[model samples]
Target: MDEFRFIDSIKPSYYRQSSVIKGVGDDGAVIQPNIGHELVISTDTMVDQIHFNLNNMSLEDVGYRVMVANISDLAAMGSSPLYYIVNISAPNSVTNEDLLYVYQGMNDIASQYRMDLIGGDTTSGHDLVISVTVFGNVSPKKKRLRSSAQIGDIVFTTGYLGEAGYGLSLLDSHKHDKLNYFVQRHIRPQPRVDFVRVTTNVNRICLNDVSDGISSELNEIANASNVSIEIDWDKVPIHKDMNHLEHSRLKQLALSAGEDFELVGTCSKGDWKLVRSLCEKDDIKVTEIGKVINRGEEPSVYLNEFGEKLSLDQSGYQHGNS
Candidate 1:
């Protein structure tokens, strides 16, 4: 939940690199020095109480999340992750063995993605926290942006919505499960890097990771592109465990709940067959809930099922919330 507020405070030397890359503005930064190679950079921070609780979170899961969060940013930009830098801050209450386990978790996932750990920083703090910065490579023209969404582009989401949010609901309800699949997602959410790798060849015009839930992501895209979104509430996919009642609230949950780290994107109508084929080959479910529209003067979200334009009470979870 750590925020970046200091362009002039953190490091003034990065100013030179800012022009070369789309720095400190977009979901991730970009650098396209060569015509053939473009560089992508993104950073994420998880703090003790803001992002996770140490009493419930395992050291390994925290470590894995340290890497996954950064990788998610790269995936959203339609780039391939190459390397990462991680910085850890922890209190003396954490043992050296615990920190080593965290590093081991980082190494394990980084290897899976073939990302090399180039460098990082470690320091003592009052609480446990992790910050990871990831670098990826993409073609200059191929780098997707949130603002690239066009009016008439179909909206799509990779995989189900509200599963992680549903998982949190269960934990809040005190119903622990032996499966623990959803809980792990909350702790160690898997970034859809493989999905990104395949979809990069498709017509994904604009893309963003659904970390802050689907509603907030859609709003971001809408605001960026200055278009309205009309999503089918029934079409919003839900996990099998989530029954009709749960599914009914999924529109609200998926829209407002944070930490559902799926890919939300826009594609042209012509690419439907190709996109569906890719989803089939990869065994990922994608649902088309809406289309970009220029009907309204102001950008808004409309729910077809409710037959009215819906308003969201929450804009995903913000930092420092209990």
Candidate 2:
């Protein structure tokens, strides 16, 4: 049989639970616990060519990132991860050592997050692809969504921006140490679990994972909340390393370049100081970057400094753009 036909030949199985069961679906197998909470389930895929270049990334990084990126989605929802399922596809040319390194990397991250690897599928493919479905739990009342923001809620991001794009820039020059931090940020983007945990009590009004740049994510949140967002350029946190780029271009990059893997969230005005202190206690840098305004502003981002509004033409890196 052909490859596509072969994959299609296998049928998915179904399962049923007793009367106490809450929900179950193919996205993930779930069961209600004695405690009342809605378990959030999500999955993500990382392709060799599209998500990471095999030539540029190590085997270990590939494995770790596949899990971390999926975990990021759960973190944005303030979910406590319980377990995960991994599915990997690789070519015959891939060596045993490479495969083992990838597994090791996955295990290392899983152990740190105390996530259990419940099940998975292994398959042979022409190239490489890793997909993971992570299961997490959060109280229904505490669930954070991008659609919940109210006008006047202050916007915040967990860390400085543009490091991932900057790291990709150095790959050509092969300047490893010159941009070690950014490189690491891209290779092993940390899942902001603890930080999300800290903000859970502050009534996290809205939430987004900064996989795409701030502009893209801000636009998404604004559209969801039916509100306009105004970001102060000066208020957007920029790391010292980001200063390597030219002034005008760098600001644009920081605002538009994607894959920063930070958390951008909203909080009521009164909770700012308390949230700031909570993050400080956890050693996480939280910056007040913007605010949600009336929808009349049309969901735009701005650079208002020195009484001038500079134009940033790029809308971040899109997959198919040349």
Candidate 3:
């Protein structure tokens, strides 16, 4: 299969958008955004063995994961996904059929979010690699930030944590059949794009998607916003399937297990009430797990379990860290 044939084969009408004046066949994509909307862009790259293993994830899963990872970044900024460009580096071992399956997976989710595929490059490489760059839009007034958290703000997270990590563990141990939910969570993590679209419209929401673990995300918010944070252990929403695990183990996964793709952030208590109320109407579960505090004598992030405080270890998937 040649490169041009491969491109033409996966091209679909759903990837076309009014905003995209020209896409795919052109030398470069041409896009025109609405008058009052600001563009938001994010890019993510995944390597075969480093980010995924064919033994555990199929080609479709790999493509879907790369797309979701990039979209999650847009969601963190309170934006709506608009368009995307995907670049692939495939080895000789990968077939055109396999590549089509990957594109099919990407298109399935892209259709759900109303995102279009623009243009990108494909090349030969020693290992399979997928790189996705996503474009989104947000109203200037409604854009959220990690550096906007305030003292006395309430911290919150969407859905359950630890499920993706537990899923990865199951995959590693080849126990995927034991827990379908956890396994699915690992391979098919959902981004909180809809949640952000609804909640951040009210403003005063400082949020980020938990791609690197909630612990690292909280610390980032604290450092960026120059505030301290205290998370209540009991309030952290661990998946029910993880109930069989020890409390300490559950806590560790909930805090440091990356790739959950759930939103975690803060809002003023008053704004939180409105956000929570609006999210509930959409059937989105938002849990208040912690609070922002003045940076007086406390660490950036700490865990509070039944009034016992412990320092949170901001250790997750850091590449090259042995």
Candidate 4:
């Protein structure tokens, strides 16, 4: 099928939104946000082999993942996703059926989040690349920032860590059991969009998505907010599947696995209690792992492992790092 036909194949009424004055088929998309709301925009690109292994991941998984990566950014800022544009470049080796499945995958997530597929472009390339640009809205008072973590604020995360890292390991071993929860996580991560929506409604503060590992994310919050962070090792939530793994290795994965897509942030103790209670009502688990310390500390991130404090290693998925 040709490009036009491909676009037509996936067109659906569900992809349309009132705010989108014009979507797909136009030179550009036109969106109008409601008054008293600020728009949050984020873009992310996923390259084949580098970001995903085509041999291991399905076309649908690729599409879904790209959307999650971009949407997670919006979620980190306490914004609700409104619209998105996807640009895809696929090699000659990819079939039209493959491309359609990709769109289906994207549509599934878009529908779930009530987001409109505004517009995008498709082209041929040496390898598959899916670039997604997402738009969201947040009231000015509810907007969260990575640089707003305050001293003495309690740090929390939405869910357990290290599952995605374990999942990727299983995938690398050519394991194809869909029943394996860990393997499922690596391919289709569940972004903490709902958590952000609920928490921001109650109280908003310093927040970020754990896309590049908790260690890297904590360092980012520390540097951005000019504060030191101390994590209690015992309070960190580890995936149940990781119980069999060596304790040290599990800790390493929990700290450095970059694809978890969980939310990490800080809030006042009172706000933290309120947020935690609200999340609990929705069946979402929030764990308080540490607190923000004063600035000017020798080490920005400290880990209290069995009462032996140590500096955390800032290591995770760094593009181009050998």
lDDT (Cα, tens digit) per residue for candidate 4, span 1-322: 3799888775555555678787887788777777899999999999998999877888898888888888899989989989988888999988778898888788778778888888888899998888999999999988889888989899998889888888988888875575678888888888888897667666557898988889899989988889888888888898766889987778778888878899999998878889889899999989999999876644388788665777775783222200
Question: Over all chains combined, what TM-score does candidate 4 have?
Answer: 0.94
lDDT by residue for model 2 over 1-322, one digit each (tens)?
1334322332223222231232222344445553787878899988888988867788888888888888888988888776777777889887555666776677677778776655566678898888989888888888889888888988999888887777777764676753387788888878888887887876655888888788777778877888777667778888886766787678656777777778887878888889899999989999998777777635544445555644222374222210
Residue 206 of model 2 has an lDDT of 80
Q: Per-residue lDDT of 76-186 in model 3, one digit per residue for the tens?
A: 998889999999999998888889888888887888888888888888889988999999999998888999999999999999998888899899998657348898898
RMSD of model 1, in Å?
8.4
What are the per-residue Cα lDDT tens digits for candidate 1 across 1-322? 1223322222223333222444443444455454577889999998987876656667887788778878888989989887666678888787666777787787678778776555566677898889998888888777888888888888888887877777776665667752587776677678888777777777556888988887778888878778777677677777776665444476556666767788888877777668878888988877787888784767765656545445432263222210
lDDT of each: 0.72, 0.73, 0.85, 0.84
Determine which window of 10 residues in candidate 3 has minimal summed lDDT.
313-322
Candidates sorted on lDDT, descending: 3, 4, 2, 1
Clashing pairs in 1: 215-255
**TM-score of each model, paired residue for residue:** 0.83, 0.84, 0.94, 0.94
Of 3 and 4, the candidate ahead on lDDT is 3
Q: Judge candidate 1 against the unseen true structure and give its global Cα lDDT, from 0 to 1.
A: 0.72
lDDT, model 4, position 85:
86
**lDDT measured at residue 244 in model 2 versus the true structure, 0 to 100:** 65
* Superior candidate under TM-score, 2 versus 3: 3
